[model samples]
Target: MNTESVDAFQARVAKHAALADPARLRIVDLLTLGDFSPTELQAELGMPSNLLSHHLRTLEGAGLATRHRSEADRRRSYIRLAAGALEGLAPGVEHGATRVLFVCTRNSARSQLAAALWQQVSEIPSTSAGTRPADRIAQGAIDVARRHGLGLADLPPRRLDQVAGVGDFVVTVCDNAHEELTILGGVHWSVPDPLRNNTEEAFEAAFTDISRRVNDLAPRVHAA
Candidate 1:
């Protein structure tokens, strides 16, 4: 190999070296599902706190993960898969057996963003609704969607009663909505309601989370 080519290969090797350990690989897998605080990671991985931090540091060096402090709780740091970190391993192809219905309390943010993200990532039909539809979608949700290259200019908050049986696959994005719509028989994300915080960052975080989960959930949603 030419000197330049050899250097490139070496760099590639170095980047992937961080993932050579099995524990790091598992950390990457968990981050794919959603962002987790160090405490949460320790509980999930049953690893020592200091060791988990070491793995996260390695991931950061390799550009495979990023960390952010929660705006509400600065003492907590959340670790998420970095931008494009999962592109090499993301799920492909939608399960077309059942249309997907995204649900939350207000349908102002989480469910709305989830459905928009699902549309961008999957071919299967998807939409959003709420337990108690807001009079209007949150402007922060709209702003964040636009920033993420999604348009929510016309999508409105829809009531759950109007869409209870609209789809065979129902994914609830809030704890309350999950309990209220238990008969829907799909997964519940337990995602926080961004409107309660009403910050640009909060809305962006909500969008990022819903987008990640929706992308991951698409491939496994085949109807029974």
Candidate 2:
């Protein structure tokens, strides 16, 4: 085999080897939906910190997971799957939802885009809201949406309490909203806040992340 093919084969072998342990496999599953701080992951898995660290190192070495410092909190770091690392991996369980509620600290960007994208792929009803509603949607978000053939200019930012109801499947699309809200049965997506940078590139990246997640989730969620 050629050198490039040998390297590709070795990488796949490393990934499978890393997931050989049940603990490491579980960590990948948890990170599939959202980014988690090591502490949060420890809490979820009830694993010792040292062991979790070992697992994280293994996943990183395998090119399956990566770390990012929190934009909201500088001291904290979160772990997430590498982009496209799970392309052919098994999907998570299917679920039922009367409605899908997308949430963020501000209803201006990630959540709004997610709700709109969900509408494109799923028959289930969806809406966007915020923990702390902004007076207006971000112009960056609006422009990105228009570029993607989705409309956000006419949508008003709503508070979570105002729009969310029982039977709604909640998806928190930002770190702040996920950490701030004590949501029952809510899924979290750690899409970075684009308003912090307010650049076209930042907004486009956020839109792409939310769009992929919404598409992945929409098919798994059925109307109840």
Candidate 3:
């Protein structure tokens, strides 16, 4: 085999080795949908802090997971699956929700695109909101949507509390919104803010990321 193929095989072997333990596998399953802090993982797993830390370190060393400081609370950190870490892995468990509510800091780009993409793929009913909303839907988002043959509605951005309802599956699409929210039972995707660059490439990248996530999640979530 070529060097590239050999390297790829070794990386896959390492990832599989890292997940050999039941505790580590469970941690990966929890992170398949959302980010979680050590405290939260500890609580969920009922595992001691020391043991949890060891597993997190092993996953990180294997390049299967990452830990980032919270954008809201600098002292706290969240653990998330590394990008493409679960490629070729089985899908996680199913979820039931009345609707899917996508959220971001400004509700200008990421959340809007996510909601639109989700609607195209699933019948679970989806909408979007912001923690601190922008004055209008971003032009960059509109352009990207048009390129993808999707329409971003002309509706004004809404605040989270105004639109979110019980049974809604909340997905925070940006790091800022995810860190700011203390909400329980929500998913967090650490997608970068594309609007910061305000370029076609940036918006397209954001759209692509959300599109993959929507496709991955749509089948797993069913209307309650």
Q: Give the candidate number with the greatest lDDT.
A: 3
lDDT of 2 by residue, 108-219 (tens): 8888888888888999999989999999889999899899899763778999888989899988888788778844547777788999999999999999988877766776
lDDT of each: 0.74, 0.85, 0.87
If candidate 3 were superposed on the true structure by all CA atoms, what would the RMSD be?
Answer: 2.5
- The candidate with the higher TM-score, 1 or 2, is 2
The better-scoring model by TM-score among 2 and 3 is: 2
lDDT of 1 by residue, 1-224 (tens): 44658766665575579778988988876666556667767987999988988998998888888887654355756677776765566544344445788888888888888888887877777888998899988889889988977987386799877875644577777767765655566655656678777999888888877776776776655653
Clashing pairs in 3: none
Ranking by lDDT: 3, 2, 1
Question: Which ranges of candidate 2 are over 4 A from the true structure?
Answer: 1-4, 183-185
Models ranked on TM-score:
2, 3, 1
* Candidate 2 residue pairs in clash (backbone atoms < 3 Å): none
